[model samples]
Target: MNIGIDIEEIKRFQKLLKDKNFIELVFSRDEIEYCSSKKKNAVQHFAVRFAGKEAVWKAINKSKKLVITDISFKNSVLGKPEVYIKGKKASYIDISFSHNKTTVVAVAVSSK
Candidate 1:
């Protein structure tokens, strides 16, 4: 098992969201749609997801670089986020995110 955590300021995503190509490159199509549907905190939403994916990637790979789009996230029925990795092992990865006005934090734990 392994664990990883990451944090980012909400404002950091504001710039990343600007480039259409970057958005496509970094986020899954559903994630892009979900964030776009938000009336407020759209950038923050994407940013938090990004942090969650990054944390999971760091936990699993340790050395290999990760492509953001390779990691996916979705909210459970209870509104908790879950992580799903593309073309990866069947291992389970649990992820959580929390945020305030200025920042967001995420943690991921992987179990084999």
Candidate 2:
């Protein structure tokens, strides 16, 4: 099993979310839509998703050929975050995320 974690500041994440190019280049359609639906704490949600992606990448330890947007989140029936890279699935990956006033953190574990 490989584990990876990431953290992001809420204010910084909100700032980056305002940049269309950054969003377009770093997030998938579902991710953008998911954050849009959050409304109240969209930045926190987006940041967690971003952290999820980063942690997943680190766990996979793949080449840099994979971009940020290459990883995405999909909720399960219980609204649990599931990880996917490109169109491939990784059911073995476990994800956890949390946030507060200043920051959000996410951890991912990939067991082969």
lDDT winner? 2
Q: Give lDDT tens digits, candidate 2, residues 47-101.
A: 8898898888888775346777778988888988888878667798899998899
Instruction: List all candidate RMSDs to the true structure.
Output: 2.2, 1.5
Model 1 misplaced regions, further than 4 Å: 63-66, 87-91
* C-alpha-based local distance difference test score of model 2: 0.85
lDDT of 2 at 99: 86
* Superposed Cα deviation of residue 36, candidate 2 (Å): 0.6
Tens digit per residue, CA lDDT, model 1, 1-112: 8898999998878887989998898888878898898869798899899888888887888755567678988776798777767844334888889889899999988874
Candidate 2: count the clashes: 0
Query: Model 1: clashing residue pairs?
Result: none
Look at candidate 2 and tell me the lDDT of residue 90.
Answer: 74
The TM-score measured for candidate 1 stands at 0.88
